[model samples]
Target: MPELPDVEGFRQVLLTCRGRRSVTDVDVRDAGVLRGVSEERLRKELEGRRLGKAWRHGKWLFVPTGDGPTLVFHFGMTGSLRCCDQEEPIEAHDRIVLTLGGERLLCYRDQRKLQGVRLADSADVDRILEGLGPDALAVDRDEFLELLSGRRGAVKSALMDQSVVAGLGNLLCDEILWRARVAPRTSTRSLSEKTLRRIHAAMGRVLATSVRDGCVPPRRSWLTGRRDDSEPVCPRCGTSMRSTRIAGRRTVWCPHCQN
Candidate 1:
């Protein structure tokens, strides 16, 4: 699944391809990738509008067109945004293509088509984002602690919950808990303030590097680097790692280190 870092990278693609440039054409190669808006409406709303600054919150990317509607993207599992040459052949998964000033093509490509695109006005944007909690990258330590304090499930579940702290997915939650030395099954309500603070700090450091790299880089020193090993071991302590399901997703941790 495309997470916050991947979505942030897509925002950069939007800015680099279309910032300040007017959309000369809109092609809906697959209308099934659109939400609520018709193909004709999408083309009508965006054709001659200048794209403003693009922003990202959690895994969602938003592109505003000055006074026109904002284009919202939620890259579910196999979705991505690509900037390619207009002369290049469209891939099999290119669902929508937007021509920027007749120079380049911005493609919305997805294999699964789980979540696609939406066109929203200012009010619609607000309503769409109202259900999400504060973005994981923007929440302060105190606010992070407060947000987890009210949760009643495992700490991993709380971190992965979009309603509790938007943006964290399965890989991120496991990595954060490992760095904080917190077990995956640890209850959020039983956590101490100091522990919560540690988790918050780990999240900051992880997100900073991940956002810069545009993915959860599988570094040898990081848990992600070893999680897929035939028999994964902790990079720090060399203890054999364990895996189980939590929040209906595969969860991995080092029993010795996290204990």
Candidate 2:
């Protein structure tokens, strides 16, 4: 799945699509990747309109148009955006193509049509985004502590809950828990203030490193780096890592370290 860092990289791709670029054409190869708007509406709304700055919140990417509407993208499990020359051969997965300024083409590609593109006016965009919690990267330590305070779910579940803090996926939750030395099944209410602070710190560090690497990098030194090994060992303690399902997601933790 494309998480925060991957979506951030998509946002960078959008930077090349914006600023004085007029949409010359829109080819909808697969309408399954579009939500709430039909192919005709998409073409009518986009063609000839100039693209402005691009914005990203959590896993969602938004591109403002010269007209009022913004092109929004939610990269479900396997979705991405790319900018290519008009003559470049299109991939089979490239569902939507927006020819920009008669030179560059912006493509919306997805393997699983789980989440798709949406066109929303500013007010509609704000209303739609109101349901999402604060972006994980934007939330500070104090805010993170407050969000986790008094939560009843397991720490890993709480971290993966989009309503609690947007942008975290399975890998991020597990990595954060491992770094903080907290069991995935540990309850947030059971966590002490010191533990919460540790979690907050680990969250910051993990997000920074992942965002920099443009993925939850499975470096050899990190837990993710070793979790899939034949006999996964704790990267820090040299102990065998433990695995279980928390909130229906596979979670790996170090029993000795997290205990």
Candidate 3:
């Protein structure tokens, strides 16, 4: 699934769509990629509108049209936004393509259309944002601690819950916990203030690095680097890494460090 870092990368892709370029065409190769708007309505609303500022919240990317509506994208599991040449051959997975100034092509490509694109006006955007928790990267330390204070569930689950803190996925949850030396099964309510501080700091560091790299980079020194090993070992202590289901997702943790 596309996480915060990945969506941030997509926001960068949307940057090219901004400025003076007008959308000359809106081609819907798969309407399944369209959430609420019909193909005709999408084309009608966007065919000649200029793209303005772009914003991202959690895993959602929003590109505002000068006309008022914003094009919101959620890159489900395998979805991606690719800026390519209009003359180039379209990939089989290209669900929607917007021709910009008849020069560039902003394509929404997805093999599994689990989550795709939606069109929203300013009021609708506010409503959608009202339901989401703060973006993990933008939340301040004090706010982060406050958010975690009420959760009694496993910390890992709380981390992955979009309503609790948006943008963290399975890999990010595991990586942050590993870096904080906190077990995935640790209850949120049991965490000391110091531990929560460590977790928040680790999350910020990890997100900064991952957002810069545009993915949860699997560097060898990080737990994510070895989580897929046949028999994974801790990067810090060389102890065998432990794995089990937590929050119904496979979790990897350093037993020695996190205990």
In order of appearance, the predictions have TM-scores of 0.96, 0.94, 0.96
lDDT of each: 0.91, 0.88, 0.91
Q: Write down the TM-score for model 3.
A: 0.96
Sort order, TM-score high to low: 1, 3, 2
| lDDT for each residue of candidate 2 in 22-76, tens digit (9 for 90 to 100) | 9999999999998999999999999999888888887888888876589999999
In candidate 3, residue 198 scores what lDDT? 97
Model 1 misplaced stretches (Cα beyond 4 Å) = none
Q: Of models 2 and 3, which has the larger lDDT? A: 3
RMSD of each: 1.2, 1.5, 1.3
Please give the RMSD of candidate 1 to the true structure.
1.2
On residues 136-189, what C-alpha lDDT tens digit does candidate 1 reach at each position?
999999999888887778999999888888899888888999999999899898
> Candidate 2 at 259: error in angstroms?
2.5
Q: Show where candidate 2 strays beyond 4 Å.
A: 17-20
Clashing pairs in 1: none
Clashes of each: 0, 0, 0
